[model samples]
Structures are given as structure tokens and as C-alpha cells.
Target: MRVEYINPFVEAAYNILREVMHGEIKRGELYLKSTSMPVLGVAAIIGLAGDVQGRVLVDMTKDTAIKVASTMLEGMEMEPLTHLNDMGKATITELANMITGQAVTKLHNLGFKFDLTPPAIFTGDNMEIADTGVEALIVPMILEHGKIEINVAIRERN
Candidate 1:
């Protein structure tokens, strides 16, 4: 994917995490990944359509999900992640929404147009996200609590 297509998501994730979570967000190595890999424990998948078309999957482990949910809750303590409640699911789903919304806005400012679907939450083991023609570019952002993998895949539509 082009930097024009990818940087908005990266910058948005960094900026939102810094502003919302108030933590040191470290971006890790980036790479292209196939869609067949089983998503960790918790994930939110959002679809994109318009000038660009594809999906974004925000992925993390269960323990990480608990910490993220707590942080997003303004440090409210979260229960064990052996099972997830609505709030736990909403936390990550909203994170994906925030990240995607800001990135889409940035892309719009740069003259790209797109609409995003509501985030779809996925849990448990061995959940697989299908590839959207193009392979996903995985960007790992590490916070004090856990690591978030932003998997972005899109192709310019005719």
C-alpha cells in the first residue's frame, strides 16, 4: 500500500492513543500479512468503501483487551477476560471506530473518499479475517498495557 493510503491510519492511532489513553505509544515493525492468520483473542473489524475499498482489523490479546478496556474507561478496573461483557467488546470496537474515523477524515482532507461500517467485534480463538484482495499491512502499536495490531488492507477502486 502507498504511504498516502497508510499514514493516516498510523498517525491517527498514535495521536488518539496519546490523547485519549495518555500513554507512551511506541510503533513497532511493520509487515505485510496474509488474512489466514488466526486473530489473537479480541478484535474489531471495520469495513471501508468508496475511493478505497477493504477492511481494518484492530487486534489484541484478552489480557490486553482488559487493560485497554480499563484505560478507555478512565482507569476503571476490569474483570478477568475469561469471558467478555458488552463493555469489553465496546471498548475495542470504539477504539477501532475512533481510529478509523480520524483516519478517514484525514484521508478526506487529502481528497480521498470513503465510508466505514460499524465495527464488528470478534473474540475467542482461531478467528480468521479474509483478505480484501490486497494483503494487509500490519502496524503494531505498543502501549503501557498491551500491543495493538492495526491491520489495514485496501485497494483503489475503479
Candidate 2:
């Protein structure tokens, strides 16, 4: 909800993505969603709790996921994936974790204490996410492989 909260995630996503993909990373305009919104096929979600509570979703199409995963794997000198298999899913999940971990570190330095759940990957044909009472702020990062949306929905705990 707060711009203060969103900036770190956006910065982290940009920094990590640029480093990992080893390509230009373009950030799109920020947008808000308060109602149910469709996901782009594959999503990696991380839950946050402590001073702030909610979740962050790294969302993208399956094709994009495959491309991203392949790029990441290639960087590690591992075989690139042709599809969203177990290794591909794990690669995406780790990407989400790295982004969240960096963002959380920044937030912690700013005095926001929180814990993050392990990243979870969800893939399907048609998927929608609705977070009651919390508005989600989405930052779209466009890469050579494809686009990934970093969706942040968090608020101070009562």
C-alpha cells in the first residue's frame, strides 16, 4: 500500500533480474489491483509476516517461465529446460526467493522486521488471485526472455 514498502521490492527485482538474466531489464509502470486478477499462468508466491503482513507474487506466463528458467540454468552451466519441469519450477521459485530476500533485507535495515515463507510455485491454465482488504501493487519487469510481474500486497500489522 505504501510507496515506501513497494520501492525496495521493485529495486530488488530489477537488480537481481539484471544480474541473473545478464540483459537489459526494463521496468514498466506501477499499477494497483484491489479485486480478483488473473495470473499469467505460472506464479511463485512468498508470504511475509511480522511488522508487515501479506504476500508477494512473482507472476509470469508458462512460456516466460520456461524461457527465464532456461536462461538461469544456462548461467549455471546446467542444461536448459524445454518446458516447466521440476527443475524449471525450482529455478523460478529460487528466483522469487532471491528477490524477496534482498527486498526484506532492505526493509529490515529500515527497521521493518518480518519473516518470509519459502517460495511456492503455482502453474495452471487459468488462475486468479484475490486478496481481501489489501490492495496489490504490481511492478512489471520486462526482460529479453519475457516479462515478470512482481506483485506486492502488504500492510502494517495491527
Candidate 3:
């Protein structure tokens, strides 16, 4: 992965977390392999195409997800993830969507135009994305209230 692409995502994450959850996110090493499956809690996956093609998975544990949703809903605590309701999915998906939309716009000004598909939220341990030919950039975010990770499974076309 290019240092260029990685930095943009980092900056994007910082902005998104600060705006969405009103919290600071500390980033860590990449979880590059598929062995990292059975991801915890809720996950939102958005596919990107056009100039960049790959899958972006944003995940957070159920507790943190609820905390985030609560924060988004204007300082109200949500019911636990055991409920597994639509509102939770909407909040998480919207968060992922917002992050991707901002990132795409930034990339456009840099001469890269990428199209992002609608985000889908998955629960439990069965969700997966087929492996892509190119190496994917994995970013792990640790937030005070939750986790926000972005998997940039896209590579620049030759």
C-alpha cells in the first residue's frame, strides 16, 4: 500500500470520529489477512469502484456501536446490541457512508475519482468479502467509546 493512500484514510478517520462520536481515535497496525474474520459486534461494509476498487469494512463492538448511536441520537443511551434493531444498523451504516463520502471527495481533488456502494451492516461471525487480487490496506482504529476500522481493499490500476 502506498503511504499516500494510507495517510488520507488516517486523516479521514480522525475527522470522522471526532465529528461523529465527539471522541479521539487512536490508530494501530493493519490486520491485513483474512484470518482476522469473525469480526466482533457490528460491521458495516461498503464497496468502492471506479478509480479505486475494493471493499471497506468499518467495524465496532456492540457496546461501542450502541454508544456511538446514542451519541448520534443526541446524548441518549441506546438499548444493548442484543436488541439487534434497524436503528442501530442505520446509525453505523450512516457513519461508514459519511466517512467514505468524505474520503472520496478528498481523493477526487487529488485526481482520483472513486465510486462507493451503499454500506451494509452485518452481525455475528459469518460475514465476509471475497479476496481481491491486489493487496489491501487495513486500518484499525481504537476510539474511547468504540472502534472504527477501515479496510481499504483497493489498489491503483496499472
Candidate 4:
């Protein structure tokens, strides 16, 4: 919940997205939510435990996921995806891993130690997420493909 904890993820997301997408990336205003919030369509969630405990969500519309995945694949000289197939899902998962891995490294350098669970991808409509006692801070990143919302809901463990 501290600003210090959130900045790394925001910076990592921006850097990773810009590097992978090779396009203009803009960050939207950050906001907090204490109640359930709607999921855009596709989300990759990773759990953190140790010094901090909670989760991080990379949320985006299915369309955005597909486009982002396609862009990533194309960068590797692979065919772009037209749907969220297994490969597409894996690509998005890897993207989540990259962002969180970088952020965790930064956090570690700042003296916080934690373990991250593998990211799980969720896709559906009319979905909502509620973190019992933690308020989620969301940073929305806009790319030419679409927008990605990086939702962080971590608190220092007592």
C-alpha cells in the first residue's frame, strides 16, 4: 500500500511494455479501491508472500490481450494471434512474469524479500475481484494496442 511499493511495479510495467510493444506507452492516473472491482476481461494474477502479502493483477480487455500477445509474438518472428489460444495465454503469462520479476528484483534491492507464485491467467466477462482487507492500487498503462491495468494489493506482513 505504500507509494514506495507501488512505484517499482509501475516503472517495470512501463519499461516492459515499451520494450516489447515498441510503441508509445502512456500511464494513466493511479487510483485506489477498497471494494470489488470489475475485471476488464483478461487478467494475470500473481501472489506475493513473506515481507509483504497480497497479489498483483495485470488486467486488460480480451482484445488488448490478443493484440499485445500478437505484437509480442511478431517481435519474435512468430505469427500473430487472432484469439486467446494456448500460445496466446502463455505469452500473456510470460509478460506478467517479466513485469513482476523486475519489480520483485527492485523490491529486493530495497530490502524487501518475498516469493511470487506463478501467474494465473483469468478470462471472463462480468468478473469482479475483492481483496478482503487490502486496498488495491491500480495503475493503468495505455498502449497503441490497448490498456493494461496493473493492480497492486500488498501490505507488510505483521
Provide TM-scores for the models: 0.90, 0.98, 0.82, 0.98
Spell out the clash pairs found in candidate 1.
Answer: none
RMSD of each: 2.3, 0.7, 2.8, 0.7
TM-score for model 2? 0.98
Q: For residues 1-158, could you state the per-residue lDDT of candidate 3 as single tens digits?
A: 65556666767877887776765668888656643454666889888888656777787777778777767766455454444478877988998888877777778878787888888988775555556466656788887885666877677656
Task: Give the lowest summed-lDDT range of ten residues in model 1.
Answer: 75-84
- The lDDT for every candidate, in the order shown, is 0.85, 0.93, 0.73, 0.93
Model 1 ranges with Cα > 4 A deviation:
75-83
lDDT pick, better of 3 and 4? 4
What would you estimate as the lDDT of candidate 4? 0.93
Counting clashing residue pairs in each candidate, in order, gives 0, 0, 0, 0
lDDT (0-100) at residue 88 of candidate 3?
A: 73
Q: Kindly list the per-residue Cα lDDT of model 1 for residues 73-144, writing each as its tens digit.
A: 765544534446788788789989999899999999999999999889989887777774688989899999
RMSD to native, candidate 1: 2.3
